[model samples]
Target: MITATPRPSATPAHLRDASLVDPLRVRRAGPGDAAALVALSEPFVRAGALRRRPFDVYAARAADFLVAEEPGGLLHGCLALRVHPDAEPGAAAAGVLYNFCVARQRQGSGLGARLLGAALTGARAQSLAALFTATTGSGRLFLRHGFAPVPQGLAPRAWARTLDPRRGARVLARAL
Candidate 1:
């Protein structure tokens, strides 16, 4: 059975405070961030906002992650650049953005934009010709970031299943 994602019982007090003051801070997540990352992502997983991988999987891959934390350290949103094994020698490396989320109340603060920009920057640095992701709600944001959809039936690994008949997450790519 799929696990249910947890919603905030109430906005954390610090977020209320941040709403009155600074809204966010972005930084690399470290070893200590595993639990918080899980908390931040659990809701999405439960809601199918992301594919549910075991906690250990996330922890094992944590180094590629980043978070937008409120001043009180509540996890607001996260994004990661997970490298895929090269399919061809000397080919441009490729990576994907996973678990992209913004806290329920913080959805419009440009956090997704910030997160995607960082992912794209990392992709360029790695000489990746393109960056890819599967979106849950809309692909417009990815399009704005220069990602175009992969043609129907030609979707890449993991991405093919991200989309369903109605709410299918289309595969998008941005040339690096």
Candidate 2:
């Protein structure tokens, strides 16, 4: 069986500094984590790194989130995975990752990689054929994890339709 947590060696060298991270810090988020999730993603939202979602939205979709918590009761990072069954009548299942953010102090410390690794595991658990994401930045992290540019027309239909032209985000996908 695939474990939900990432093994130390599963992360790429460039993405995580193993000596600075705790593999166990990343855990599934519960409804109780809603507010923290919102707070954690707030900076990204303000910087246009992510879209804004209110508190109730976070509470309602808490099940879709995975969060990295510090021993001091702070959320250091978070990522959400929304599974979409198919793009066409017979396409394989797939998932879209969103609201990905790591505390500014925590960036480049492997917490983000560990979070991504965990979400990849979750996607596999759901029998997903691919994982997709839209990013406004260089997407270097996604590239290191094997994601490549995907034409919007080739991405999951339902999910692709939601992409905002105003954001000018690039679409990327990694097939499982």
Candidate 3:
């Protein structure tokens, strides 16, 4: 039999009050944010909703991330947009969204939607031809944001090549 340990929630106790909906500003992440990124995504990783990634990887690719932050340096959410050039047969550029996470206290308060919106805006800013993401969950948020079901082959070839078969993630795409 396997036993699981009860880890303390990453959310601070004071922030758990459901009525407290503080303003969270979404911004691009920097190299110094690796530790917080790992902490913010740890629960999702443990829940099997996200693939586990190391601190070094986050640090190395910090520019690909966007984080939701409140005053006093608290991070409530994060998402990564990895731009893939030479993505398709015709040399179309695209972005692959990944590592999306929100603190439990911030979920359902439109923070997730806000993050997705920011990512879409960023993709547009970069003039990406399309945006793609793979999700193991219901993907209702992505669907609501105009991402529809797509074959893995439709995603950026380099990204699709790296997907783990065992994770069974469904690919979704939306044109920019």
Listed per model in order, the count of residue pairs whose N, CA or C atoms clash below 3 Å is 3, 0, 0
Top candidate by TM-score: 3
Model 2 stretches with alpha carbons more than 4 Å out: 1-24, 87-90
Q: After superposition, how far is residue 62 of candidate 3 from its true place, in Å?
A: 0.7
Cα lDDT of candidate 1 equals 0.75
Q: What's the TM-score of every candidate structure? A: 0.76, 0.85, 0.85
- Colliding pairs, model 2: none
**Comparing candidate 2 with candidate 3, which one achieves the higher lDDT?**
3
Per-residue lDDT of model 1, residues 1-176, tens digit only: 89999885986677665335556787888878888888888888889767776778778878889788878988888898877655578776667777787888778777788777777777778777667777766777788888888764433455445556565666777767
Better of 2 and 3 by TM-score: 3
For each candidate in the order shown, give its overall lDDT on alpha carbons: 0.75, 0.88, 0.92
User: After superposition, which runs of candidate 3 have C-alpha atoms over 4 Å from their true positions?
Assistant: 1-22, 87-90
Once model 1 is optimally superposed onto the true structure by TM-score, how far is the C-alpha of residue 141 displaced, in angstroms? 1.4
Residues 107-145, candidate 2: write the lDDT tens digits: 877778889999999999888999999999999999999
* Candidate 2 global TM-score: 0.85
